[model samples]
Target: MANPPAVTVCLAGNVGRYKSSLPVGQLLLRGIMAGAYIAVGAALCTVAGTGVAPLLGAGFAKFIGGAVFPVGLIAIVLTGMELFTGDAMLGPLSVLQGKIGWGKVLNNWLWVYIGNLIGSLAYAYIMVWGPFTQGALGAAEPNAFGLNAVAIAVGKTLAYKSVGSIGLWSCFLAAIGCNFLVNVAIMLGITAKEFIGKFFGIWFPIMAFVATGFEHCVANMYFLPTGLWITQLFPSLVDKSTKAADGTVTYWSPLLHKFGGLTWGDVWLWNIIPATLGNIVGGMIFVGFVYYFAFRNEFPEDLMK
Candidate 1:
């Protein structure tokens, strides 16, 4: 049997209430695991989608990547690991139920986000030195997987920066869309009473977010940094010369011009920073508050216990 909506909302709060009480160390450790799990999915998405576009067409290739990307979140949820994106909604919802304080919510967010970053970076290094690089341990050109990483990074950062402020807004909006669906996916997982039900519930929304081209900060923590690290190791991968309108040669992208080559500032400003804010709004306001009000008066009596 399926759980009722109110019961699901209450269960989410119960999770939030329980998680809020965990010590910093436990939260961080779970967060680390969650980040790595998410990166596992991100890496698979990048590798699987590598040459698929040429054979299956662009839209289908993206669909393939998106389809595989949900496995990370599935593993995280089933294993009971903490994800910052899900926490963004869960923490606030816990507070709304008067089950936890805002301070605890903030604390949870801070530690989980940091833990996720560390885990993502660690996995990024693994991919950079392992699957992304050549067989002789960085001796040869980056394989197709590495090339896809570079392409994903460039498109997220440089492509957005080229459009100016509008690009930032686009990133921000995309992030909002991402976390909104992410939390909905989380709620669906909670709504399910059976393992198989939870699995499918989580899979579809996550697949939709990635397939639809939404921005997710935690996943980006892996995706962007991995791309940056790989490019640093193989600068030639990004080098390219393009013809200018004046017929003069311009070095950019593959040529290494424009934004002066993917700085930390560009990474955060173009993608991460705005994406984080948008995620907060998406999860906190859209899912947290919306659900809180939806079931506020109808909360189960067991919740009072």
Candidate 2:
């Protein structure tokens, strides 16, 4: 059976408070695992979504990709790992409940965010040198999966930059939608009394967000780096001149060439930076504060202390 919303809110607050109290080392360790888990899902989504749009239909391919993307979060929740996005909500909520202070909340977020970045970079390297490659350090051409990685990175970064300020707003908005749904999934999981219930509860909202093409900061931690690694190893993929119908070779993705190729700068300015801001707003205000007030009157008296 499902848990009541009030019960779920209290449970979430307690969980957040307990997490805040954990040792920094423990938080970092768990955060690393959570980042890797989220990367696993991101990789799976990339592979599953590859060529799917062409073979099937755009909508169906999105469904397939989104369907597989929740495995990481499921593992994180069930196995007890610290993900930055979920904690973005949980930490502040604990602060508001008077169970933890602002310092603890910020401390937890800082360490976990660092750990997550390290883990994600590690996984991104593993992917670029292994599965995404053609069994060599450098290739004249990247394989389909590698190409897809590059494409994904480009779409997230350069594509947005091409449109200027409006594009930044678009990515920011997408990030907000993403974490809002992600926290909903987390809340639903908290509401479930059984594992299966939690599994399905978390699955649906996650799938919805990914299928809708929302930006997620943790997942991008993997996606962007992996793609950057791939392009570096195979620089040809970035600005290869291709034969045109008019018999002159021109660069692929005009804007990509115009931006002087994708850089770490573009990755942050175009996508991750704004996405991170949106994630905070989405999780902290949209989910964390909203739920706190929604069930404010119903919190356990002991918890109010």
Candidate 3:
């Protein structure tokens, strides 16, 4: 994060002997910040799914959830923020090239992970408030992006593990492919520094992931919990003959009636945690660190020393 202690300078004793460190806490903080950025992007996409998306009706609504994840990730990369999944690649690279010790990668992973959860929760709060209070996006009488959005997310999430359990590595493979594009998206957005260049950079991966049905870790952060929140907050989003202090609270029961006994736990247990883990593994070990091994030649000579 702080330029990897400048391998050349440290190795040369330019500033006296120094050791490379991951400083677990710092990596965690970066992860948290990255997560918050991602959560915001998730909320934006949710709003788009409910109302007028930034890209307009051009993108598919369901894929809109997935699309927003990378869009948010690319922005974080462009902004030079850290993310766990992307870190997975970088962390390993650092270790393999001797830029940082193995201890650092583990520390970095722990921090980013905790931070990612905090960011995800923050996004959920904004999403519930957006449609509930302002009706900002011109949602339907029963907004799918509202209560229905969660339900659909729950269904989509389970499909992955259920398929995975049947020995379908499609989801696992998809996760890897998503990383290649995801990293590329970050590369373009972060380094390209042009709107269309960055946008087009993201466009190809975003489209490819959608077209090929790749698994994304961050989108699930918003989608799965948001679904549970929808189930939890369903009571809050109802229309009232008389508006009270608790319109959303009132809506939950009746929506359950309409949907036939939906439970919030189902979203959490069957969908959220598994999908979240899949996403984490996909981002960290699968995608992130793998690249580290592949690109050891790019490192500064100090690291080699």
Candidate 4:
């Protein structure tokens, strides 16, 4: 998640030496699993993005990501894995609260890491290689008029400043701030003595996050660019010449490119990357240190082990 507080905490916790550490591979793997959790959430957002308007008024067409996406994220955070966004908080919180040992955090981090990579990669492949890949791909491309609309959709919402104007530090800060609220919601779920009340408590903030455009760093790993970036989503009828990175061949996906006209790469560069970084910054920094400093007085003994 590299959310808002991540960098600050990295600096802050490093002072007390309370931060968790692991091999580089494990750290990367944890990020991947966290990314997978995010990808699932993003996929839900993508569905909301495309189907909401047309399906409006239909109960089934309700925007799913703004509420349902966080439900799954809870499972990822609690069940185990190195969810980067939440991990930025949860792992540290566990240590500070005396709920779990740092070693256990590392274990959770490992599996989740691998799961995230598999998840993000698999989800991306499905969106790119599967039936809807072409249609999704076509939506993100620069139009025949040569404008990248998908990029605009994502960047506008994420940057909160300008298209192609937001800097790296800004994305980092904003993303972390957004996720800080997310972590608070999750903490409620984890701390509540009752499951029903927990669900009730957790639902509100998550919904708020989605409705208000508070970014979840992990979800960005999937939704922002993949929804608009890859060209394969445009289908083959219009452009048979485009090929994969290997440059071995070009093939039509499913939809006809002349119909919708989007691509993956266009979305990836303009929308996905920017938004991804934005989510990370928003969640990690903005949210991270706010809680850490606020609750520093409550630091427990068990986490010190």
Instruction: Assess candidate 2 and give its lDDT.
Output: 0.88
Q: What is the lDDT of residue 300 in candidate 4?
A: 48
Q: How close to the true structure is residue 57 of candidate 1, measured as C-alpha lDDT?
A: 96
lDDT of 1 by residue, 132-208 (tens): 88554445457778878978988888888898999999999999999999999999999998999999999999999
Give a tens-digit lDDT track for model 4, residues 62-128.
3455666666566554554456556656565545544446675566545554556566766756654
Cα lDDT, all candidates: 0.88, 0.88, 0.54, 0.50
Please state the error at residue 279 of candidate 1 in Å: 0.8
Instruction: List CA RMSD, all candidates.
Output: 2.4, 1.5, 8.4, 10.2
Ranking by TM-score: 2, 1, 3, 4
TM-score of 3: 0.65
lDDT of 2 by residue, 1-305 (tens): 98778778888888889887889999899999999999999999989989999889999989998999999999999998998899999989888888889898888888888888888888888888888885876558677888888888988988899899999999999999999999999999999989999999999999999999999998998999888777778776657778979998788656656766678988888898899889988999999999999999988776565
Question: In candidate 3, how many Å is residue 46 off?
Answer: 3.0
Which is the better candidate, 1 or 3, if ranked by TM-score?
A: 1
Superposed Cα deviation of residue 204, candidate 1 (Å): 0.1
Index of the highest-TM-score prediction: 2
lDDT of 3: 0.54
